[model samples]
Target chain A: MNETSRAVGWKPRGWDVLNIVLLSLLALATMYPFYYIFIYSISVPEEALKGVYLIPRGFSLQNYVHIFKQDNILWAFFISVARTVVGTVLTLLCCTAFSYGISKRNVPFRKLMYGAVIVTMYISPGLIPWYITMKSYGLQNNFLLYILPGLMVAFYIVLIKTYIEELPAALEESAMVDGASYYQMLFRIVLPLSIPVLATVAIFNAVNQWNSWVDNLYLASDLKLQTLQMLLYTYVNQQTAALSMINSNSTAQTAFVMTPTSVQMTITMIATLPILFVYPFLQRFFLKGLMLGAVKG
Target chain B: MEKTAPRKRKIEVPLLVLTVPFFLIVVLFSYVPLWGWSIAFVDYVPGRSILESAFAGFKYFHRLFDSTSDFGTVLRNTLVLSFLHLICSPLPVLLAIMITNLRSGRFAKFIQTVTSFPNFISWIIVYSVFFSFFSIDDGMLNKLLYGTLHWIKEPSNLLSDPRWTWWFMTLATVWKTVGWTAIIYIAAIAGIDQEQYQAAEVDGASRFKQAIHITIPGIMPTFTILLLLNIGNMLNVGFDQYYVFGNALVQEKIDVIDTYTYRVGLLNMDFSYSTAAGIFKSLVSVILLFTANFVTRRTSGRSIM
Candidate 1:
């Protein structure tokens, strides 16, 4: 490709340079907000109050120290982790198993069941009905609300099923010949072979579970069930109230020094940190998963 | 084949048993909600069975169209937001083309990676980032404009300003999704036959000409399918972005159907009326989807469904 472009005497033209420059500006624009937040979180409260741009004026871990001291922050972090781990695992298991069943052409009511799942991808019963249904199911204020309703996402089911259908049937046939039960085949043969798609689904589910707070807002009102995202939303929306709550809990010296802006940035960093850490490693899989879904969809 | 057929039959019952739990879950979560649609038709009362509630016929649906209701504002916001989104749909294609045209593969990859990062973060964090930059007081933009640059005399409350709410929401959504959406177009560009590019190059077509004549046309099918899908989702301006960005000051401008439903059903305890609005939205969405599909099938000789 390089040789061909060279053969055409294709040098770095003005348009190419302009494209590169504009894209770099876009990339900077996308990244600068996060950088600004990080700098503000670490800068001295007085300096951050004046406004931070480009870099931190004074380095301090005081904001983080104060964040860690708050019990609700720690509790929300714990709840967020619990939901991501448990929710992703259950979603993978249930969605993959169900997709495996649906992949079988000879299963009774296979078309009906598969059609039902696909239909859901197009239509939703809207928010009010969905809320009413969840409330009736005793999911309000329940941890199961996070795990159960999301267990078998129709999109994930379709992705896994498409992958499973394309797999070599010989392996499953051989396993069945060995008298492997349906459970054993699913756990042993299908699940093992479906790792790529499963990894994709797992990352998608984990990120969603971590990022979601609306369910917490609407269905689960218990303080104990609050996730990190919910806490961030609360802090962002109710800045003065959150600031007072933080100041009221802190020692006088620290409270006097700490500003609401720094605390807010600190909380924002905390909520976003985990995703930042894992994104680079898992992004390729989700991107691949997306392409796979796009093709099948 | 005969031996395997018998074996398959033998385990059929177990397979059916394995599927029952998932089937039940789908029915409970997805199908059961349809029953709640009935609330829109009746005088739904809490703690009473839907069947026992007094039948109100189409009273709520009629009220949805009444000039006095908030539905008019909600519908206007929803359509305006959706239209803004539709107009900006070409951005991802533009981004994809630019990324593909880059001379350095590594820089293109870096651009893609960084731009897509925002998509993974939650809207709450996005709001936090927005607040830090655009909030009225002590926000970075305000501080810079009113303090350092003296670009403006007073701090601008970009987040709460009602006049530009639709456009601002569109910008936020585009910023969050453009990179992610471009991936599919990038994939489509990759799928375009390499021979076509080679042929164009051999014919003395400049790279710019090649992109215009070949690459843009190649990705049209994917673009069309996505546009149709967006049309199908015309009423669903999403619940999250609006919900988080909304303030009492901007409520009139930002209250799309989903947020309106949530406020009326849960906050105001008007479940029946909200259900009526929701049902109307859903019915229109389904009709739009089929209409788009039908139009595509008729015009392009292909159907999205």
Candidate 2:
């Protein structure tokens, strides 16, 4: 294991060094920000204000503790979780129904119906019109505001429809010959075969529903109804003056002091971790979904 | 074509039953909003039907062009930010190339995964990371620059400064999606025939030369397709980042079309004025899509359609 023998087998040590160094730098660039924020969240106020707090200064769970203790945060988390689950399921259901019907090559005016969905992909009716329409539907300040308008995404419908189109028609033909109705075939045959794509689309919808803030910003104004993303948005934008009220807790004297920065970092981590944790499980399906688009498109 | 096959109209009954709800919903949600664009033509007020509203054609359109609407500034902000994003679009291609060039397989994979992780988190969370790094007076960057490096006298308000908004927002967006965006290019690279690289190796081609001659050209079609799509979406920059980032001090630089529409239409209840702006934006987007399609067809002999 001499240096000269090691050098003999490898062709370009310089290139390897450059490659490793550059990639290492890039890795750090992408990763260090998360590390920095985590350190800041856990760092004591005095140490955070002081020199180079790379590691946690005092090792405190108080910031995270304070975050869950607040009523606003608890309610916001529940709303976000509920909406994400509900919105994603409804969206998948709507997309599956529409795409399943249209994917049938024999359906009359199928192209026209598919064209209708595609046209909306390129042309939004414009934001003001959209807002007015949503308000007109009496969704303003309602929980349905988060779920109803997004139930049928044209793009996802197109993707699912394309996936369904690729399935062997013989499966449907045999099922039909057995006197299976369209509903029975779709649920029993099409959906079971299309699970990979369905999972991918579901992941996309769930992540989107959880992450969405703009709809909440416009449609849900009641303090009681704001989702976690909206709460995070409000905190980030410094629009809410109610943050100071959290500090008024009597346990503040007994506990490590909680700052807005600490609470925000904790909230951001809480909102972010669920998606990040689930991402590895979904990445394979997600990449497969990407292939579904790429191969057909 | 399949005329000999059984025409099962009965199956369609259930299929149509399943699909009809979505169709009606789309008509209500999407088509109704498109019809709302007509508000730009009239002095729309609450409680009055659009037909009953006076037929004041282009009145709000006129306001859009006039200084009263501040439309010029909004257009400038939107176009400038989008243009910046367009210019930086090639960075993803560069990143893909760099990753492919790396000799260490595990290291390259790790970098790809770490970079794409940012894309999973929404922009609001991105803002928190950004705030931690750049919030004025006490921010990490300020602490390093002023306290440690003696770079400047005053701690600049980097977040709210008009001068920094475009670059900052673009960096924020690019930072989040660059690696994720690079995935398509990586796929393009993978799709390139391995035999070509083996042939090049036998011809005594260097790695750099191989990348130049084989890898870059291999992904050209994907590059062009993405470029055309980007051009088609030139006017469709959404309001999330700008809405979250814009402040009173930097309002002039960051008040893009979406944000301006939200403010005027919803906040001020100036429905007619905002609808006019929305109409203008949509018209530009439609024209750009057509133009992009035409140009792509002319050059590459392919169109998005």
Candidate 3:
């Protein structure tokens, strides 16, 4: 490549080097805020604010201990875990079934159903009515509150439908001729053939469910049912234990020691870790699925 | 790609039947909730059915449009914030393109991963970082400024000051989301055929000029689609970030339709009035989407639909 570049009268420009340096610096700036929080989370809260540059004076697991001691942390983690798993499964099923049904160009009222999903995606009735409906239905305080509202996203359904549409028709027709039922064809052929896009939808739904917080804020009032992000918000912003510690002649050092910023960061890590763990495996599929939908005419 | 049986091709009733479950979910969660628009007309009460609520037809909506209300302030704030985002959001796309210019693929992806990390952190964490940088005490920014030229006694409370709050919010948004936003544009650039670039280079075109003439035009379709999509969702000034970062002092400047709905419906139990406001928001969003789609159709022969 270097010899070819030289032969072509191409020289690596200084402007390119400058641009690279500037972009790297900007990326660093974007990253430093989270990096700083991770640093603070481990430092005694007092040392955190006092420009604890690069190293923790006294690193401790005390903050994590404090977070766990709150009685609801472990429960919230489980609820979040269960919610992500259950919600993703249910969503995948609903979306896939609907997508499969709709993908058949000859299905009765297919366009109408497709139109219904697309309209809903483009026009949400906003959160107020959705909240009202959930409350009126008495889904609040129920574990189903976390799972039910999340299922059957239109975009995922459409993506899956598009992917199914691309499959060779002969494969499905041959199966149909060989004494296979519709369900049998879908299960044995369509699904296995559509694994890549299915995994793509699964990852997208899982990450969305795991990261969601706004719905729970309005619906789930039970302390035990609180998800990880909600719990983190309550602790970091509203909790008086750390605030009271900060006041009442407590030194800056003491305030720093008490605030569980480290644990909070860890909580963030925990909440997002599942998605991060799954991402590497699904990265190629995700990129493929994304491009397939995004770039198609 | 799939072929069907040629003998009077039949619609699969069983397969169509499978749609019932999904239809039920959509109707229950989506279509049924359209009835909640009536909440705007009534003094909605908890425990009472929506039908039983006291009727106050268009009263809340009137109040929303009333100049006496801070509806104008909020409307103005929403517009300005979104406009600023519209203008400044493209900076990261340029940044991403610059990074992509680096021949080293590993270096580019590393920069991308690092920049995109903040998108995963909750706004609460971002708020904490803001305090560290802008708090009235020994904030890093203030420390640096003071040491360079002893300006003041304390770090300026950028979070509390309304003048600075919008900038703070904008910066926070840019820092967290810009990287993720740029990923699509970067992908768009990557989708460009390299043959054009080679042709331009053979014509003795500089990298910069070639980028302007060939690279940009190649990705213009993606740009048009993204621009249309963004304009359609302009009203969605994400409630999460603003709510987490907002304080009482800056609420006037930062309060959006979503936050206002939360306060009115969830906090005060003015369900009908809040529902009315929400309905108005949805209507506006639908109008925007249609208008944007129409514009795109006319200009580029492409529509989101």
Note the B-chain TM-score for every model: 0.94, 0.92, 0.88
Any runs in candidate 1 off by more than 4 Å, and if so which?
A: A1-12, A253-256, B1-11
Candidates 2 and 3 compared by DockQ, better number: 2
Ranking by TM-score: 1, 2, 3
- Put down candidate 3 lDDT per residue, B1-305, tens digits, no spaces: 23754555576677777786787898888888788777788877777877887788889999888878766777777777888787785676686677678888998887777666666556755665665566555455675566445687655778789998778788988887877667778888888898998887777676776778987787787778778877887887878887877779999999888888888789988777778778887788789988999999998898776
lDDT of 3 by residue, A53-138 (tens): 56664787655655555456778888878888999989988888888887777777778878888778766766778888888888
TM-score, first chain, each model: 0.91, 0.89, 0.82
Docking class of 1: medium
- Give the TM-score (vs. native) of candidate 2: 0.93
Q: In order, what DockQ does each candidate have?
A: 0.55, 0.50, 0.42
Model 1's DockQ?
Answer: 0.55
Cα displacement (Å) at residue A256, model 1: 7.0
Candidate lDDT scores, in order, read 0.88, 0.82, 0.74
- Runs of candidate 3 exceeding 4 Å displacement: A1-12, A44-49, A105-107, A239-257, A279-286, A295-297, B1-13, B128-153
